[model samples]
Target: MNRSARRDGTPDRGRGNPARSASDKRATDKRATDKRATGKKDAPGAGRSGGAPKKPHRGQANTAAVATNKRGKPKQAKPQRQQVEANPTISNAKPARHQYVQSAGPVKLAAGEGMRLQKVLAQAGVASRRAAEELIEQGRVEVDGHIVVEQGLRVDPENAVVRVDGVRVVVKKDLVHIALNKPRGWQSTMSDDLGRPCIGDIVSERVSAGQRLFHVGRLDADTEGLILLTNDGDLAHRLMHPSFEVPKTYLATVNGVVERGLGKTLKAGVELEDGPAKVDAFTLLDVNGKQSLVKVVLHEGRKHIVRRLLEAVGHPVKRLVRTDIGPVALGDGRPGTLRVIGPGEVGALYKAVGL
Candidate 1:
């Protein structure tokens, strides 16, 4: 046998083509090394598919380690993770905190606590809810002295000072507004210093303690009719102010017949002792042989204005009873009777003075 031949009759690796021998030895060594490291054989046809086993990437693998099943099919390996025990005494999360801030504008009432502003105005007889909203939109309504335009704004009506058209509205529960039918001889004064019959005697038993009221306008000792008495000073002042021009109505019995042209003359404005005055309206209701029952409407508050106006027309008044003031009327109420003004009437009065 040749000295370099193997016992199987194959050329000895050390005796084959030198370069080819080296390459075959390296290939054999690589396969043996890979088998030792992986403890597994190459997949069938793996060498023909890619020609070589690729080295691991520079970084750790992102994929899970793979394994083979009983059928030699690859399956994902269960991930291995370090186990950690929880410590009840320590936590990394932070707790939450709550805070609140108040505003400088009108105080905001909590939910379901106070009444709506427009409703308050409506209840206080300022206007209907719809009209009150319109007033607020026009920048004419105020609450707690600030012009509030927001609808449904909550308010404490008893505490809030509301105004419309610059006229203060009385909303407090303790404040009283009364309409008294004065007797013919009852003085308009709150209290008669001379011990004569006056308004105080009539209202003293009707009102609560400490509720002192003042008359809006005075009537003569002989005149009788509807007179407003209230603790609302602002309303009284506005009603009495000449610029407001709140019309008053009177039923007067005068001597001699009222001429047809008398109403025209009275409305044309008759010159009075203090100033020129005019009747807003006039109507002759009934005619007797020598006396006439006439209705006169005027905005003047001059002393005995109704009597003076009638006398100026050549028919002197014998008895004059005011039937209405602004939106209020006596409505056949007996003498010395007192009635709390209704909300509608009060609202009408507020509108009359531009409130």
Candidate 2:
């Protein structure tokens, strides 16, 4: 083998050239310096090393004592994270709180000092006492610009400002009385749930707007006659009371011929399902042997009183119509017609009811 050839059959250039030998030595030294400067151990399988790198100790990873500066000095302990003390005066440390307070109770009233709100409203013809209470509860009734929801609240009727739904309520002193010649098949109520024709249909248009008119007494759907309509609840109530004895007169056409003494029998008393019903007067108007027209007067306002009384006497009434209630007569007003009750009739009604 030649001197330039190695035993492994490779060229021995580094041994043959001094300059190449010096260059290889300097390259190795530079790599060693670089590794030491980076403070990292030589990698495995790198720079003639052929083993896996050693792992760092478990606890030494997080310890500040294991960490060092470039000069091999331990890093100054991260200025020890200072503890903060909370200042109570600072709003961020403790949030501001709100204090709550309770509301005041209702005001008390003296005895008879002010009229009850419901009574005033009812007397003003707004509604019944129960309905007025509902209005107050619904926050619809207000007095002097304040909404009143409490029951039994009273205010001066004449002096205090009362309103319903922002409309000032004025208590009407001048009472209105209307007499209607109600037609058959017309309900006595202002409204009917079954959509039947009601007396209000004929009388409501004639009366002033916002006037709440109620029938003084109810009449059956079949009966057509003089029925009183008024907003005067007190007068109506008194007229309807049993103690007042406001008489009602009716003309009934019966199926049988009434003999003489039948009037006396009816005047005496007729035993009814409710109680013994008595008529003030009963008169036979006309008898044609086939059917008879009879006039009956009674103070009781029982339902179907005239029909029931005649039926109990074996004479079933074929047609019944009320002609008079107290002194208010049906006059010449036709069926489904209404007329204003004159002052004379109104006075007589009030006198009859003792109102």
Candidate 3:
């Protein structure tokens, strides 16, 4: 065994530690000193955690800067705006320029004129809204040299050029709401079956074929009086709905004079096999020795409700005549004769029924 540096100040450089020249030994020592001073590491990924170099943070700069992409390269960004209204702040901002838009709707040729296209055709008494739509589809309506097939298309009236079936239409001056005093022995419908005369027959030349007129309500072939016919559908429906509870007055000719307490029983409420019934008000107006005409005012449109009510009170109705319904009555209206129900008369009926 030989030792390079013995315990004594003597050199034994041989065998295991080969002897080196002075210059070579100096060079080797310089390398070890340089490594210690520069802190050169042995491992390839020295000072790195989990085999990865830590990413540069917001405040930190790159120790070894990488070359950037071209000038056209885009920067990494968050999600982009999705739709027009996504940003409320931008949406609420004022426009940079004045915005003006014109609708392709029906226009009145004259200034200050206001009317819908479908309604203008209907007012001209040509046809109804549905019928007007048909006219448009048939290419009969033209506006400003353009055939308008779209019913939803609106136009300027005065400037707009319109022709229906090649005929110019003028919206009518006014609308009419007329009622007829329906006579008895005739069905309350517009037309009659069983070859019987209808209430429409009694209305005379007032109702034109082009006008859309219908009865507000119906009366049985036997139930006569105040038959209201009008072109107004909304009024007819509201007046007929049971929720309104419109009072209808009737004059019923019963077999016997109603008993003394019979009126009380009716006023109190009488139970029928079908259901209970109540009269708003009742009074025995006449009694001619076992014959009587009882005027019944009730708010019911049930099938044969008046006759059934009389029957429930032990008085079967022989003949029934409706005197009034809601705000109109059959005044001096003969069995088969009719008169126009005036506004004054209608007003009284409204008060009587509290409409």
Range of the 10 consecutive residues with the lowest summed lDDT in candidate 2: 99-108
Which regions of candidate 3 deviate over 4 angstroms? Answer: 1-179, 341-355
The lDDT values for all models are 0.82, 0.81, 0.65
TM-score of 1: 0.59
lDDT of 2 by residue, 1-355 (tens): 6887799999888787889789878978998899889988655445543345545577556332377779977776568777879788766545449655453433436767878889988877678999999999999987766788999986766466677776566543445688889898889888889989998777666455777788888999999999988878878999999999988999999997898999899988989999999899988889987899999999998889889999999999888899999888999988988787764576567567654
Candidate 2, superposed: residue stretches over 4 Å from native: 1-174, 206-208
Which parts of model 1 are misplaced by more than 4 Å?
A: 1-107, 111-153, 159-170
TM-score of 3: 0.48
Report residue 340 deviation for candidate 2 (angstroms): 0.6
Model 1 worst lDDT run, 10 consecutive residues: 44-53
Best by TM-score: 1
Which residue pairs collide in model 1, if any? none
Write the residue-wise lDDT of candidate 1 on 225-308 in tens digits.
889998877678899998998989899999998889988998899998888888899999999999999998888888988888
lDDT of 3 by residue, 287-317 (tens): 8777788888988677788888888777888
